[model samples]
Target: MGSGVLCIAESAGNELKKSAFELAGVGQRLAGALGGPISGALVGEGISGLVEGLGKRGLPKVYVVDDAALGRYTSDGYAIALKAVVQAADPAVILLASSAMGKDLGPALAARLGCGIISDAIALEVVDGKVHATRPVFAGKAQLEVEPADLPVVVSVRPNVFEPAASGDGAAETVAVDADLTGEQIRVVVKELLEPEERTIDLTEADIIVSGGRGLKGPEHFHLIEELAAVLGGVVGASRAVVDAGWRPHTEQVGQTGKTVSPKLYVACGISGAIQHLAGMSSSKCIVAVNKDPEAPVFKVADYGIVGDVFEVLPELIKAVKEKKGL
Candidate 1:
């Protein structure tokens, strides 16, 4: 029988990603409920520095597969490496973050192991000695509770949904494993990586997000949104309408057809909240809506509503934030 919970840790530039910590916390809870220890699996090159931190964050055991070929992310290489870890650990439950890497790896790994997988899970718990997961469905319109049908179940959790586990005094026992993957096994190779010039926090991982809509008038007015987000130390987001208008990139668009974000504070500027837009950010902890239209749909879900023009309100908000921060 499978035993314990194993969390697949993801990293970038040799540092653990935020999703890794979140999934670790999820794994910790599942392990506690199952009365078993939680372990972590890291697959990358020169990632030994991350192992100690993972251990401190309540993981008693951490499996490391540091290979030069695994430095850059590829589906086959990562999948094969993770397969080796799963075989060694023999975990009852496998948890991964619902990031790009996790989404790709979770299903592939599950297919290889012949186990049921729950993807984009927002919540997980042990009910009646079985793992039960809650995830958004129907384009974020509703949520469904699911239980994996097979042993050694796999789950990919949504990023930023779960709080990270706190640090502890216990040191993690590190175990290095050999995947022994050959050149032919890795079909896809990354030729070049082109990063964006202005690096902003990922929308899925940002704590505070300030989003704009068509009310901004044109693409040139986006500076108003950017300025406010800068003062608040938050990322800038956009409605699908503006994205469709070519005012902003699709990467910044938030809606049923775009990325889903659950930030701590979501500020909607000039947005007339369509259901599709709300589907993406309705799960935010606190929503502040600013719009000229008093009855805008976004105001319905906002914790605080401001019936004012974004151009007029944004400058004042930015000034207040700067003053408060002594910037």
Candidate 2:
């Protein structure tokens, strides 16, 4: 049987993403239980510089797939490159971050390797020498533990749920793998990349998020949400209702249908906390809800709840945060 864990490291704009370290943390834990070495797979163009950082996070060895054709993420291109590393390393388990790219890449890579995959796993443990995964089910209403029936299964871990491993003074040994990719192999060609007008932290990786819902009544009042987020140095989030009503962009939506976030602090302003919305952020370390309704469902899942109008309460909360930071 194969042994050890391999982390599928991801990067953007040549910089290592926070999820890369988070994946390393998960790999280290699983590798310790399996009593095997932990390695990493780094794919992309000119990403050799990131190998040293992964080593400091406990991955002493990494397989790199570097080529000019992989300047952007393409499902077919990445899957083909990763297949080569998987063949060389033959890890017992593969771990990936459940981000947008991972959500797409995980299934493709698993299909290529003809292995079973568990997506959006919140926790992993070794049971009787086999890797068992725990993931949310039924819209975060319950938890389910699954064990793959075969060896070398793939798992996509929820972002921010695992603590990022601390970096150490270590370097990694890199094995270069050729990314034998061609334009004909990639069915989809990304003509251009459109950057968001406002460059903010990805919701899944944000430490703090301030989300607004329809209770704000209109898009004109979303400034309240933006101001609070700015004061706390957090990303802005929105509920499905807000997005559907054109009050916020779909990218900012936080729900089962939107981005799943587990930030350090989640502030819900004017949100009633639908089950779908809760499913996305229920894992947040601390949740603070503000609404006029005394029995809003948001309070049920919140660490703290304010039973008052957001218009009246948000200013005070923002003021308190500013004072605390002496801003």
Candidate 3:
């Protein structure tokens, strides 16, 4: 059997991502069940500054690989650095967030390590010294449990599913390592990092989401959703139909074909709640539906339902929210 659990930490702008702390909590639990210490690996430029924070987040040891070449995320460079950490740690299981970087790096790293991987895991546990991961399958309609056939199993966890671990009193031991990657080994080079024009909380990371659909009428009417989202301090989401109709960008789509979000509150405005759309947000803690059609499928799952037109209802709702919050 392999030794402890090693969580791969992801960072943006030299700050640790929320998923990193979630993975730390997961690693700590797995290590307890497997009878070993919890450790973490951070790969990026100037990552030493993050070591102290990771230490207090319950990791006993952190493997740091700070290199200039790793300043921008390239699949080859990150894979090479993570490979070095895995070799030294010899962990029984590896946990990563199912973010863009993790989705790209997890497979490559697993292939390099010659291990099987369970992607987008929502739940993890150790049963009889083996890691068992539960994930959505068949378009999020079913749940599947996976167990790796060999040691050093790799698992990528979905964002927002797990709570981040609280910080501890003591600091973790930092281990500096070298990836020994050559220019020739890095087959792909990153030329630039393009950012979105308007940055908001990612759907997977947001606690509350206000979504709209065709009932809102036109592309210009998305402002209603945006205004409500702003009032609630939440992000704006849209149904796939709106996206397909060119009313909204695909980034804001929430459905089987788009990003799955598990927020604390999901307010569906003018949405009929198709199964594909429900597949994405049915996991939300509370759902509020506002639609003219009382028999809409969305009402079946909604905690609160209002049978009314979105345009007339939205203005009143926004005003109510503002008054309630004294905003």
Candidate 4:
């Protein structure tokens, strides 16, 4: 296995994304399996410092493409730059995080490089001398194994799914390159970015998540949910109905249209667990549901189910948790 691994790094808000480092950890393992070194690639404006973070995760070389034109993300420009680096590196496997930017850039790079692409790949391994990718199919109801019969297999790994590997004394060798494409040459324009709330932990990154739904009755009821989240050291999430009702922001929604999370534990209160909602959080390691309706779908996949009014059950649950922790 002479093929090396290339892990793409994503940075924003001056912090190296955990997904980037975790995917590199995966790439490191894959590279070792293939008897080669794993390298990381980062492209953006004034992003040279992000290499130290990647380097600690066992990444040897970090390719940087710094250009003012790349200050804001554009699929066409990023795709062009990544394709150039990937071509130059000639790695057999390329890994990217499943962020919004990644979803746009990864496929564009694959198309530019004329390679088969697999998106939202949860698990990856070598199969028959090729990359075997496992991804959700039929809208997360089933899994599909994708075997790309091409060079440089492109895979997008979901956030928080792979934990970042422990650090080593790995130092980064920076490889500088030009943007290679101009802004005038690109077709799309990004006027603004509606950033998410910074103080709250992103649902995809939360180790523990407590979600609320219609049972909460009104937007003000989210206070209880937030209180419980604060106690559990977790994030507060909402179902689609609550979001559409304007009780919660769309960024806090957890469903097929929103972010997917595979946390160590997911506590759903009042949510009836619509199919779309389950599609997003079903992969959670453990689920706890509290609902008045005994027939709610949330209990079907729940490891622990409590049939009672959410208002009554949530307070009790919070009290029990606090007492357990001596808080």
lDDT of each: 0.89, 0.92, 0.91, 0.86
In angstroms, the error of model 1 at 80 is 1.2
For residues 69-115, could you state the per-residue lDDT of candidate 2 as single tens digits? 78788899899999999998889999999999999999999999999
Q: Give the number of the best model, judged by TM-score.
A: 2
Better of 3 and 4 by TM-score: 4
Could you tell me the TM-score of candidate 2? 0.97
Position 241, candidate 4: lDDT: 96
Candidate 1 regions exceeding 4 Å error are: none
Q: Write the per-residue lDDT of candidate 1 for residues 117-188, one digit (tens) a residue.
A: 999898899999999999988767789999977779889988888998887876888899999989999998
Error of 3 at 37 (Å): 1.3
- Model 2: ten consecutive residues of lowest lDDT: 182-191
Better of 1 and 4 by TM-score: 4
Which residue segments of model 4 deviate by more than 4 Å? 196-198
Per-candidate TM-score against the hidden true structure = 0.94, 0.97, 0.94, 0.95
True-structure lDDT of candidate 1: 0.89
Which of the predicted structures, 1 or 2, would earn the higher lDDT when compared with the native? 2
Residue 315 in candidate 2 has what lDDT?
A: 89
lDDT agreement of model 3 with the native: 0.91
Specify the highest-lDDT model's number: 2
